[model samples]
Structures are given as C-alpha cells and as structure tokens.
Target chain A: MPYGYVNSMKTRPGHRDEVAAILTGGADGLRAAGCRLYVVGLDAADDVTIWVSEVWESKDHHDASLRLPETRAAITRAMPLLTGEFSSRETIIAGGLGVTAG
Target chain B: MPYGYVNSMKTRPGHRDEVAAILTGGADGLRAAGCRLYVVGLDAADDVTIWVSEVWESKDHHDASLRLPETRAAITRAMPLLTGEFSSRETIIAGGLGVTAG
Candidate 1:
C-alpha cells in the first residue's frame, strides 16, 4: 500500500551532535516533500535515544510534508536537544512483517 | 522519564475486527509484563492500517515482554489479516514535544 511514518525522538545525553545537525538540515525538505525514507538513529548504549524512520507516499504525502517550511525549521532546531518527552505516530503499511533489508 | 515503544501494523481492508480481537487477547500478557500503556487505533478513513503505542518502564522491560508466548502468538495471529506490511521501532523519551492528553 505504501504509507508509512514512524517518528521517535529522545535525545539528551550530550545532544547527539546537535540532533544530527537538525536531522541533516531537514533532509532535503523531507526529500522534496515526497520523502521516500529519511532515517536518523542513535541508541547504542544510550545517546539520548533518537530514532526516526519515515517512508511517505500516501496519507496525503504525509500531511503535505508537515506543512513544509523545511519541515517547520527542522522541528524548530530539534527543540533544544531534547531530554525526555518527544512522541510521534502515523502508519499504514498493511501487508505482513518484513523489514530486514538494512 | 520513561522509555516507550511504538508499533505500527497495516491490516487488510475488512479485517479490523479480527485484528482487534487478537490484540485484546494479548493485552493482559503485556500488562502483566509491566506495560504501562497499550492502545490500538484504526484510521478513520482506512480500516486496514493499524497503529499501536506502548509505554514501558524501560527498554529491558519491553524486550522481556516480547519473550512472553502470549505476545508472540498475538503477532502471529494478526499476520494473515494484514494487507500491505507491518513495521515497528522502539525509542527513549527525551523531553521536548509533549503529547496532548487524551
């Protein structure tokens, strides 16, 4: 079906390189508003615990790429390196379970 | 604060009932294993896509819960009702964005 969005943010310990440089400057505006997959992972023994896996081609192009504006300034510069309370949810892939392709 | 896990599974067009049943069955096992929050939601427009939000005391707790037979069986039962694909990821809550209480 091709609709996906998994966003998990939890970064604090040492900032994780300023939240991966604000998620690589919004990752080309979320791949030019279509966003195939923009990933940022860090949690090898903590690092504040940040995880984002996004693949969008539906749900209205992931809600119009979160209203662009470079995805709201890369979430306002990652909201001050976060310490413990970021959450996100949106998903619709509906097939089975197969995600071992690194 | 606390660690959490978000699991998203997309179901078939007309299998929401069956899917929900399986989830309900496994709810206790999860809760008994120390799960704090376990909520399942279905999209308004699409009935196939499913999303699950889980809050655990810690990563270790979450991992251990999966080892429970009840948890595994629930997943296996829902496998057939799915249509597109299913994926999940875990994260730590680093204070920043706050979810509106429901």
Candidate 2:
C-alpha cells in the first residue's frame, strides 16, 4: 500500500496565501522526491486553513522528502505564518483511482 | 474549478472497517450522483480514522447526493459505528490531475 497523509495547517490571519505559495512552489519538488501525488488546497470554510493531500511511495519517502534542504526551507518559511494548530492524519492507502498498490 | 472536500471521520474502536465498507459501497452511488472522484482511505497513524477525499462536479451535487435515498441509507447504516467527531474541510479545487474544472 502507498503511504498517504492529510495534513491540515492553520495559517495566521492574512498569511494563508503566503503559506499556500510555499506549499505550491514545493509541489514540483515533492514530485521529484518520490511523491506520486501532491495537492495543496485552500480551505473554503475557513480562510486560515490549508490542506495538503499527499500520496508517496512509502512513509520513508515522505520522511526523506522533509529532510531535503528545499523542503526544510519551505517549512521554515511557512512556520512563522502558521498558527500552530493542525489536524494531521497519516494513512496507509489501500486502493484508490490514482494510487497504485504497493 | 471543481468542488473538493476532505472529510476525516472517526470510527469507534473496531468499526473503521465497517464504516469503510459503507463508504466504498457508496462510491458508485456517489459517482452516479455527480462525484467526479471519491477516495476512501484508512488512517495509518490511527486505525480509527477514515479519510474521504472527494471531487464533485459542484457543491450542489454533493449536497444533493446526501438527499438521495441510497446515500442517506448508507449514512444511516454507518452512523452507529461513527464516533461523531470529524474534520471536514471543503475547498474550491483549482486544477489538479484527474479533475475536470467547471
């Protein structure tokens, strides 16, 4: 099974757009880092919340991506704008339309 | 843009599989109701969490589905097993793979 994670982050008041940019900018980079799917979306109900839905080859691939310099830098940049409240649910994707079983 | 929603529902101790079944069984029903894509995944970090990521033709289509007899029936069947606690984030999907913009 592929590793999937739904990460929800709350951005400080007007910083949601900034945080979104950081995530979107890193999207292509993530694809190069063993990511099968990476989606960055702005929550409609609340302007402060950002959602990142990811599908990776493995949990190790996800962890390794975070350790990369660019990934680390992006997180650092978005941290200051974040409110620190988040709902992260990591999952072992069983099967899905775009996901390939492992 | 397609309307997208990420819903994280919690199942009581051993009911995750049961809830998953209901979600999967309703997958076809959802498509019949204008669901462009529906993915059900079980949380890895926690066995009780079920993540449903959806892409709809419109938010109205989603709301309408809930009103459908079959969809309502499935929801009722899964209710008893659900913990009633969930994280639902609705978004305006700005262009992602496999989604057709409206």
Candidate 3:
C-alpha cells in the first residue's frame, strides 16, 4: 500500500508563498525519490496556512526523501518561514482514481 | 486550476470500513462528475478517522456532485456511521505529479 498524508502548516506572517515555493521547489527530486504525488495547496480560507498532500511508494521512501540534500535544503529554507503550528493525518492509501496501488 | 481538499472524518466506533466503502462505492460516478482524484485513506494512527483527498475540475463540479442520487444516498447511509467530527482544508491545486490541473 502507498503511504500518504495530508499535512497542514502555518507559515510565519507574510511567508506562506515563500514556504509554498520551498516545498514545491524540490518536486522533481521528490518524484525521483518515489513520490507518487506531491501537491502543494494554498488554504482557501487563510493566508498563512498551507496544505500539502503527498503519497509515497512507502513510508521508507518518504522518510528517506527527507534526508536527501535538496530535500533537506528545502526544509531549511522553509523552516524559518513556518510558525510551527501544524497538523497531519498519516494514512495508508487504499487507492482511487489517478492512483495505482502496489 | 483544479479545486481540491484534504478532508478528514471520524466514523462511529467500528464503522470505519463501512464508511470507507460508502465513500469509494460511488467512484465511477465521481469520475464522470469531473473528479480528477478521489483517494480514500485510512489513518495510520487511528481506526476511526478516514482521510479523503480530492481534486475536481472546478468547485462547481464538486458542489454538483453532492446532489447526485448516488452521492446523496451514500451520504445518508454513511451519516449514521459517522460521528459528525470533520476537518477540511479547501484548496486550489497549483500542480503536481499524477494530478492534471485545468
């Protein structure tokens, strides 16, 4: 089964866009790291909150991605912009349209 | 851009599978309704919460889907199995792997 999560983060005031950019900046690397999906979304109702929905081949793939140089750099760039408030729901993807499970 | 959200719902005790079944039962109809993705995921840390990640061609398409007979019926059937606890973050999909935005 694919590992996935919908994670929410609050960026420091006036930094949501920057944080979003950092998150999506490493998309190509993530794809190469076995990411099935990596979506960055701006919260419709708030300026400081961003939502990231991701699906990886496995939890190991996701964890390993974070250790990649580019991924680590991106996180460093985004860390300062974040307010530290976050929420996440980790999941075992069951499958649906546009997603092929292994 | 595609309209999307990561929605979480808590099911009544021991009804998670039933609720998940109801959510995915109308998958075919959702595709015809312009849904790009509709992924059902089981929370890794809990048995009662389910996460649904969705992307629609537009918000209008999503709103219209709620009125479909199958959708309405599913909602009705699943309602009793739910705890009324929900959390969602509406989004405008920027772009990502596996999701084609309009």
Strongest candidate by DockQ: 3
Ranking by lDDT: 3, 2, 1
- Per-model TM against the reference: 0.49, 0.81, 0.93
Question: Candidate 2's error at A35, in angstroms?
Answer: 1.7
User: Against the hidden true structure, what lDDT does model 1 obtain?
Assistant: 0.60
For model 3, residues A79-101, the per-residue Cα lDDT tens digits are 88888999887898877777755
Q: How close is candidate 3 to the true structure, as a TM-score?
A: 0.93
lDDT of 1 by residue, A5-97 (tens): 555667677887688667755655666676655445444445676665455666788788778787777777777777657766565443222
Model 3 CA lDDT for position B48: 96
Off by over 4 Å in 3: B100-102
Question: How good is the docking of model 1, as DockQ?
Answer: 0.08
The predicted structure with the larger DockQ, 1 or 2, is 2
* Tens-digit lDDT string for candidate 3 (B1-102): 789877999999899988987887778899999898888899999999999999999999999999999889999999999999998878987676776544
Give the Cα-based TM-score of candidate 1 against the true structure: 0.49
Please give the clash total of every predicted structure, in order: 15, 1, 0
Instruction: Please provide, for model 2 over A1-102, each residue's C-alpha lDDT reduced to its tens digit, 9 standing for 90 to 100.
Output: 778888888999999878877776766677788887766667898789877777888999999998999988988898999989997778877554445456
Model 1 sits at an interface RMSD, in angstroms, of 10.0
